[model samples]
Target: MHPPTWLTAFLDLPADEFDAAVAFWQAVTGYSLSAYRGEREEFATLLPAAGDAFLRVQSVESGPAGVHLDLHAPDQVFEVRRSPGGLAYCLVSGTESERPAPTTWEDGNRSQVDQVCIDIPPALWDDECAFWASATGWELVQGGRPEFRRLRRPARQPLNILLQRLDEPDGPVRAHLDLSADDRAAEVRRHERLGAQVDRVHEGWTVMRPPAGPVYCVTGRVPSADPT
Candidate 1:
């Protein structure tokens, strides 16, 4: 497969929680909702003020509600498939070039929803990481910790791929969004004000559960760094 020209993270919400999920995400990301599309009006793009949007929300009729990534490349028919570790991803033809700026909070802290962390069972870790690095044609940067591996994203690409080695012996692969913030605590507090709750606070990142979707993390990384 050709290297993706762009990457977009999609929050797939169930029908019953669609509106609430859209509202919560829009509030946290400071993005304006675009007109709903799709046959059932179940898809909407989150438009950024200064750059091309790299995020969207969709109402799903079946299957689990969670996040998925869209790999955008030029001149291709849309296709969806499961990764070696079983995470679902889409290949779309639409092209995107601009990357959105991080949102600056009232407290002078900045944050961006920049990375998608794939949680893979220990046995699947090696193959999963190899598949992603080859599939995306991005530089694979070995993580400092043994449990993590990151893709060194291209300059214009909006999202980073993080492969997390789970401790479990075997299980279905899953993914979660992660926000890098200048001040992790402040960002967590802001999200809490928007109806999110702290799930756990680790030394390097804070786990958070939004009012209406799967859990994510607020990490202590710089908002502006592409983690290149």
Candidate 2:
């Protein structure tokens, strides 16, 4: 009702978070899979009496890795393009969220960001957007805003995630996590040569500050990959 859903997938990653975690864990422990592979490098979907719950989805090259995620509705195996640095797909949870609200990492570790969020609810936003279009690698960024369905991100890390309004409805999580750094675009141009601002025109990332708020810093996006 306020701001939870595992702190909105640990700050960001919604927009189709693995189709809201494999269509709500296969409609609550029904189990199902098979239908993923444009190339296939990673895949997961299980319930096993609702315990070892699974939902992986991997296969990156031109996209994916910032903790990849994708979820929206009906239509699987294809059609999830938008994250070409525009970033969006992050967060999924209908009700399962009891781990968030915590942070502290400049190398010290001590984390939480809700351990990377996911909560479902909103009527399972169309099979959780087909398990977030195969766990994000499905690619898809630069979305819309015909008012409000959800979109408030710097891709988490001090940033907040909210998009309530869509008729409102909640309940479903089970588990989730995505936070990333995989050498993001040379860290977004090394934060635009150190000043920070790398926009790249539209559907982009990198907007540093650090003094304490507004930080999506990956400027020039990493290069050799190593948030160290």
Candidate 3:
């Protein structure tokens, strides 16, 4: 079988705001910084204390901040698509070196990014989902809600992808990260202390806005299992 694809979450930010974004994210995710990449120094990777890194930050020349994914498949290539607001993703071939496994945080708070939700315009929902499904070779599962669909990775994979169909068909497509937390309330508080403001609460999930970054969610889902 082909090796499991390595997934990395990319946080795209304005050039001027990139540093603040990286600092905020590093604190919230408990990750350290890796040397910047790209000729323009627009790329930086977030390294977990152990295990493969699944997060990165990029400074874009223009446009509002957003999120996207990078899939590293040894010998695969995929077409890139740009949405209304310039959101796009591409798959490239590369080898991912393994790292030390992750351990519990010193503060004893446990959290990890377990899902990425792509917000797509209703008109492009089917096509977008098809593209991602094809790129990742993940199975598409019907979502519990009418406007949602899930592209689940294999059991051995470390992250999941979700597609959310928006009511407005002309809006820009964007994405956000979802972190699993064992103690939802405490996790929210921890992020708040680190400069994230609670945007609102939906169901049992807390929508948070980082000091100067895109919004993300902290859910009560267990970090060690598939999110409900």
Best by TM-score: 1
Q: What do the candidate models score in CA lDDT, each in turn?
A: 0.88, 0.32, 0.78
| TM values, all candidates | 0.96, 0.24, 0.87
The lowest-lDDT stretch of 10 consecutive residues in candidate 1 is 219-228
> In model 1, what lDDT does residue 217 have?
93
Q: In model 2, where do residues sit more than 4 Å from their true spots? A: 1-38, 46-54, 62-64, 75-78, 83-85, 88-228
Local accuracy of candidate 1 as per-residue lDDT tens digits, 12-112: 89898889889999999988999999999999999988778889899999876789989888896799988987889999997778888888878888899
Which lDDT tens digits does candidate 2 get at residues 88-142? Answer: 4443333432222222224322221112233345566545444443343233232
**TM-score of candidate 1 against the unseen true structure:** 0.96
Deviation (Å) of 101 in candidate 2: 18
Evaluation by lDDT, superior candidate among 2 and 3: 3
lDDT tens digits by residue: candidate 3, 33-103: 99988899889888877667778899999888888877777876664556444568756565664432323
RMSD of each: 1.6, 16.0, 3.4
